[model samples]
Target: MSESSGEKTEQPTQKKLDDARKKGQVAKSQDLVSAALLVGSMGIVFLLTGNFIGGQIVGLTQKSIQQAATFRGELDMATAGDVLLEGLTTLALTLAPLFLVVFILAALVGYIQVGALFSTEALKPDMNRLNPFTAFQQKFFKSRTYIEFAKTILKLVIATGIASYTILGSRHMLPSLARVSPAETSQFILAQIVELGLAVAICFVALGALDFFLQKFLHIQDLKMTKQEVKEEWKEQEGDPHIKAERRALHMELLNEASAQAVRESDVVLVNPTHVAVALRYDRKTMQAPQITAKGADLIAAQIRKVAQEAGVPIKRDVALARALYELEVNSEIPENLYEAIAIVLRWAYTVAETHPRS
Candidate 1:
């Protein structure tokens, strides 16, 4: 039974594809490194900006506290609310533009690493992807995903623990902070900021490194090709051997058919038996010399002669001319060197055939 249209056809396997799957194409490590640098730079900018903003806020709050104690004026809650509102409004106006600039810079830096081409094909839903078995196979069965999940958990635990430690450590310094002079307090805050920043930076750097490796592993896994897909690609690119042989055979058959047609329509067949055959046609008004219509050897030569006999076309038995024409003038004008000789033979034959007028 013939295969249905929708059924998949088998094709030749390519070793190149197998090799590619085993050693997947390498991702640009430079891009990932650039991305990491951009992320770390953004973190540094956020840390510096946040610290500066917090220091300004604390200074304003402290001034308000001092004014409340020293001034003999009535404690107006409405005035306090107005001052607080103005402070918040000023902060919002100043920091909104700064945050916008930082965000745009960070986005541009990330784009420089990953490029700007947004591939929406990756977002398209696939029925195969929704299968529970396939999902399970990818998440748990795949070593890459299993490792990524573990790394993610480790990163979360480490970052949270480090951040918690920094906050707790700040509490230890807070009690003595009230007793110190303003200059000393400021110096101690600066020291604490540096310590916390260093801790956060170190923790995130380790997590980023793990994320980078996990990303690389996932990319390589995704690029892997199945055996069947590799075979189909080979068939599409480099044709199947069996199909190629069949096409070659069909091409030869068509050539034979064309040769047969030329033979049957020819005016005369000149032959050196199986070795040579040349079919010639001449029209006195249309052509200055006889044109060779077809030529071939062995079985084809015999077929040409047989067709010429059935069509009542002349058969000249000149071994030298037949062999020469077959070798040099197959489907072309007869050579200038042999034209005079051929004219003489044709004139003589015409005379003989005209006088006899065979019944």
Candidate 2:
């Protein structure tokens, strides 16, 4: 039976929390590696597609210009629609392979983390999971909901503030750009792109900081354990107290039965007064040495002696040998040191049995 934890289980100490976090933080290395590879491959595909798109756009523009010059007029509207359709078709074609690769990569990541034991049980509809009360408790009572809400609000405020600041900073540029030449316009556009990128980088840093804190919080929360829970788990794993006692009782009963069976068949039942008893048997073809068919103590010892007398099996009084046999041997063979003594006892018993043959 398992030992119980005290009535009040204290929350995990800092040390315990650290240990739990260490155990839980066994990151899936293969999944992460595969994810990196997948992202790199997808990035390459997108880069190639972007180049193709740029070339197609540049080529189309040049062709339109040539057509306009040849016709001695502006390009026809119908041809523009054809150009748009061709660009869209090319975009779709470029994206198809990338999408397929992404889908397979995501599946690989999941497989690496959890293996291929896909359970339809998880997919089956659960009414309890969708219940309003369950949802409310999960969202409010659970710490996860609070953390998610805080992160969402933080992201919104930071992103909006940065975007507003950047837009305000660019107000004068817009009016100036409206009055600029093509060369000046290109310079202004380049400056705007740099400004926008810096603002995005600041927002990204804030997001990363939030992610680190959120993960730490979740790790700590999961490590917290109640005493009652530990005790219950221990009992379930090691066995219930009552169940263990019952099993021990049954085991002793079986041992007694085995002892009785051994006594009836044994050539000799050796006893050390009331404390220990060992029944031994020797069959020339079946065993090279005497085998301890069964052994017992106290009341079981008395039973073994009684059964031996009823079966006409010989009984020998060897206190030291009996104790040694009972202590050393289990359900099998006699000790090697006791072989000479056991052989002498067996020879005497067989001689007596042969002299007084069974009626």
Candidate of highest lDDT: 2
Residue-level lDDT tens digits of model 1 in 264-342:
6666677766556788777789888888888767545666776667655677787888888887655677889999877
RMSD to the hidden true structure, all candidates: 19.2, 16.3
Which residue pairs show backbone clashes in model 2?
A: none
Q: Report the Cα lDDT for residue 98, model 1.
A: 58
Residue pairs in candidate 1 whose N, alpha carbon or C atoms collide under 3 angstroms = none
Give lDDT tens digits, candidate 2, residues 1-359: 12254333355555464454344442223324333444545454344435574466456667666655775555588976876677667667755766676667656654554354433555668898979999888878987678668766875776678768878888877888777898578656645555554555455544544454555555545655677665565466447777667556645784556666666777778888776778888888988778888787865676677777788887788888888888756557776887888888788888867886533
How many steric overlaps are in each model, in order? 0, 0
Model 2, residue 42: C-alpha shift (Å): 15
Clashes of 1: 0
